[model samples]
Target: MTTSQRWISTAINHALLLGAIELEQTDRGTRPHRLPAAARAQWPDPQLLMVEGQPSGMRLAFRTTATAIELETIPTKRIYVGMPPRPDGVYDLLIDGQLARQGSVSGGDSLTINMSTGSATHERGAPGVLSFEGLPAGDKTIEIWLPHDETTELVDLRTNAPVEPIGTNGAPVWLHHGSSISHGSNATHPTGTWPAVAATAAGVSLINLGFGGSAIVDPFVARTIRDARADLISIKLGINVVNTDAMRLRAFGPAVHGFLDTIREGHKTTPILLMSPIYCPIHEDTPGPTAPDFVDGKLSFKASGDPAEIAMGKLTLNVIRDTLSKIVTQRAATDSNIHYLDGRDLYGEVDSAALPLPDRLHPDGDTHRLMGERFAALAFAPGGALAH
Candidate 1:
């Protein structure tokens, strides 16, 4: 079919195409695939009968008893071939070194297990984790086409081993998006991102789409959130764009609106909240006229941002929040489920009283704990804004 025809066909049949994909290897030697950081933003964890490391990019071994499996996950979008202009996206799955499943994906997609019941379908939930179920109860090798751009790092694998099950209630689905801070910057483990902590507190499943150095408002992200399955959702916006000085004025406004518009497309009435950037003096009100300095020879940026920019009709935090508040407030008038929660409320002057983020930018693990607790109370608690 021609390109136009293919696009039309895909758009028409997209909804009908849904399910988890598999890439099994006949050879057991390559039991687990290593997915590295260099890879793009989304992908699956390597399947395995065993695992090692923090589980972020850990390795997994395949066991025999496993029959069929399904992987419901998010993709990193970056693929590599040991090269430069990094391959645009994810790698295809190969079974026993042969193409088994295509690696292509959309903004938000779900992978269902094709296997039958009694088998095990492991859910890594990692930006990329091999999803699986069903097995011969023996040893099997699952291979994932590593993105050429990323340095290989294997995450985790779920097995049919005799272990304690999580429970009957199943985990709550917590959808989260934020800057590198929420991406586990200085955190200890994948399960340690601040959002992860909050998920633990709420006893929910986590869908973490916190990209490092790329948290600017993107329509793709909002689209992802809209289609993503979640019992709750939170968006940590600002900060990254501010620090990188990504936007000046003209672009920021439409970006935010586009972001919101895209999200509302799929999740027409899902409970959504908008959060401003965390406290960072460097990007405060000062304008770009400010210069960079160094402490101990390390470069440090000054806010040098101008509140006047917003005053004079430029877009600033005061602008972003004001814009978001007005929009959400207005949206609330017609859309009761829509809401706005100030980032400051999460760690405003009062909450920051005893817990100051180490870098004055990102929250530390301990601070993450505090933030999660506070969020649980203010948003997730009974009668909380989110609950409502």
Candidate 2:
């Protein structure tokens, strides 16, 4: 450590953390989790465990006079067995509420997965330091947004000057739950995610519960949302359920109703916006159990379920959207705060033609930005469902 630098352990200062639902005390340091310990314990699927710890909307916020800062973190990066190595997760630094700089940590733990075999291997590596030097002098609010896709355990935080936690700023909190699209798949950075973008534009604090492949309307997830403090709540459904083929029409409707029932148990009159899936040509009409298609060395996804089965209750994007719309309309009769939004309105056929999803499933960086802008306009504008 440098002679002028004062090192601070995140383990001792819990107040500096923001956006995470829980802070897990790890062997290396503290790891932020989007899901609570009890919820995680209830459903310990490996995929859910990894995504919940990725900290999509989590960041470290403090007020400091430091001219430079350094953070040591051990990040668990994911790797596919055959595809090219993914780039290191980007760390975005905001000074006085504006993005000022970006950085990334190099080597750390790696989790290699063989998707075809449904197997993964973890390799431990040394912690890497992310350094941000030569900041503008004087007291300022600083925020370090961690990687949205990586599981990071913060080891140390060091700065050239004294730092103090920046407590709640009295902004309304928006709690959103969805699948990978909201979890930030293929987005360049954490703030680039649609939910983050919408939160910033809407002038609300975000608590993202967007797990990649794990947003299948689990009871525990609904219970977590029931207990959270939120001024606005949105649940983007359909994509994960269709892709995983976890439920059929017979069970999907009641499962969603039950999920909403649990949330209403706590947030009786809070505005709830229920959204369906966006335009994905591959799954729009086809049922899934989506499967990865590494065609000609490039990754893509294809629906594997037969279309004929959809008549027998297999869920498709179209079917799910219709179901969600009907459910919301039926509930809005007695409950005025419940609302429904067609995900296609956010990214419809027109959008698909203009900015096609690079992977036939997840949107690209540009699309993410576009979707965020569209959502902000649709939901946060005056006379909108979530408008204040």
Candidate 3:
């Protein structure tokens, strides 16, 4: 313990890290990892590197008698050039099991990204502090959910009283992987993201592997899932593949099969749900290469690939849905635990018309709530696909 700073080691008692495979200690602080270091070494894409480094579902859970808590962190906030400044990533405080307060660091290093040019520029900033005070005078479980989209380095934790680490809370683990939509894009806060909402509704621990622009059925991702300890698993596939023009129908089927095969190797009977793309009108029948549309300075996506390519089995949302259904049916014949939930069932044409995706690719806050509520009822409710 450093008496001068009065900050205790997070590695000591009272800090329980969930949904992370490893923590890489750095000079500034510690960076959490969902994927193992070996897997990260295999895929060196700058985008993948950025996404994985952003701790989405990770949290600092502990049992403390302290009335006040403070944490110092260096967060890498993202900035999109020529767009409205994004809100700072939120740090939610859950006392006992309910939300007690929400806080955010005002100043942090910035990573300026130009989605149009696929370029990024980094700027250094000083670490900021988050404080929560005036707690009831008793032992309580405090969970600090990190920012979903920003890369954060946890530097120090200070409290008025000694704290102890929280053990497993006996919640079932839900390991989910998908695109930026699942990574909390456009979601108002970290806890408001669809997966976070669904995890809370269903009472499960979340291990979110949602990587923006990077959920393209990669084998390393499959292997990561294969090794994770999860009670339920889900993969929301297809959008990234289509948007990147990554694969056609032929490679798509094989890639999906291979990904599933790898996961099944470790979790032979664990309920695994495969979700197709939601109702994306621009990419419904047309192929992508989705291009960003800056409509009046706001970003939206439009399908840039030719609709005529469907004859050649180029991927589209509709076709991907059909393929996923067939794959689930065939797999379920041999493995009853395998299931399929059409992504449209979560967010469809009706929902789109009423609450269209502001970006034409990602759901807005309300839609995320709607999708989360619908998904929780559909997949985690009794007799639902993920019901354990």
Candidate 4:
């Protein structure tokens, strides 16, 4: 079998298989294209080598703030990445970054990062950040840029390159799911994905389920996430649910209930964080029935679902949240384990200025970095993995 196919098969066979991911063009390539020969030897860890093929021009360097972990085990945390623009068609995995067993690029032809699936990213345009963990646990800078093309120079001045290490645990697993925003569109590389940023800030594992326009509370997705094991977990709802215009009020309630219900079935008591959605001026408080061509200035939208349905208050995020609030309130009574976090809290209107998504949909890497740090502060505590 091809290298990419083998890795996909090993999804079950391999325990360390990446879990969370936000994919674009679900029907794209199974893996990224091959790496430039030189890049192969350099990027060895999966944490860093997110593009396709081999790990050539890639290198690791670091800057520390508090204490450092003596750079051991591929400084997994905060592995930064940046890539030049590419045609919006298909591509392959260039090279293997930090931790790689064996994989390929261009499986589906689409480009994205399956943070949990051990997949590679297909560059959209420009250069952005890529992150790694296992840092020395101080204010550290890390960068990992991969692109075999001759016209790209990836660099990270704000944060240091490579990364120091904290030398703890295995590596935090990050699990995420959302709409196009979460799928790494417009962002430069897999490391630039918000989940990646968040993963770095909080220093935990990631399992991104952020499908480009597919996070409509699919029972299968929930089941998939529930079954996957990880040290941390999160789900970004609202935007996708509302944007897709999936379900009405009645259905939204049950869907949320079922989604969480299934997750609880698997996670039970794993600090499951339920996030709302970020601020998109066009759809902030508006209802859906979202058809294409709805715009509030430069902000253009497709209304997501059926407007008639939204008029009924059945397909709006507000309505969904209200229902979720009620469900969680009640569920919290019995299921104290489940936690609800308003998505607005993460990226509300006020944040629109400081952390603007160049396209105004997803959060940029810097914002993602902030969100991750906040999440770690709120979700994690001193020493232990989860919050008390």
The TM-scores, one per candidate, come to 0.58, 0.96, 0.95, 0.57
In model 2, how large is the Cα lDDT of residue 273? 98
Ranking by lDDT: 2, 3, 1, 4
Write down the RMSD of all candidates, one decimal each: 15.1, 1.6, 2.4, 13.0
lDDT of 3: 0.87
Residue 45, candidate 2: C-alpha displacement in angstroms? 1.0
lDDT of 4 by residue, 1-388 (tens): 1223211011110121133122111121122222222333453544223332211122232234422111111111111123233332111121222322111122112344443444655544333223222335445433232322111222222222222422213665656656555655444455555565556556554545555555677676676677666556667777766665666676777787899888878887776667676667656656654543424433334445444556676556666666666777878888766667776666677788776756546566577656655666666656323553
lDDT string, candidate 3, 98-138, tens digits: 98899999787899999778899999889999988777879
Best prediction by lDDT: 2
Q: After superposition, how far is residue 117 of candidate 3 from its true place, in Å?
A: 3.9
Global local distance difference test of model 2: 0.90
Off by over 4 Å in 1: 1-152, 155-169, 248-250, 287-293, 297-301, 306-308, 312-314, 351-353
Residue 383, candidate 2: how far off, in angstroms? 1.7
Residue 51's lDDT within candidate 3 is: 86
Over 1-388, each residue of candidate 2 has an lDDT whose tens digit, in order, gives 4666665544325478778888878788887888889998997998999999998988888899888889999988889887788888999999988999998898889999998898999999999999998899999999898999988888888877778886557778899999999999999998999998898899888889999998999999999999988889999999999889999999999999999999999999999999999999999989999998876789989999999998899999999999999999999999999999999988999989999888899998888988999999999899888997
Off by over 4 Å in 4: 1-17, 20-169, 289-311, 354-357, 381-388
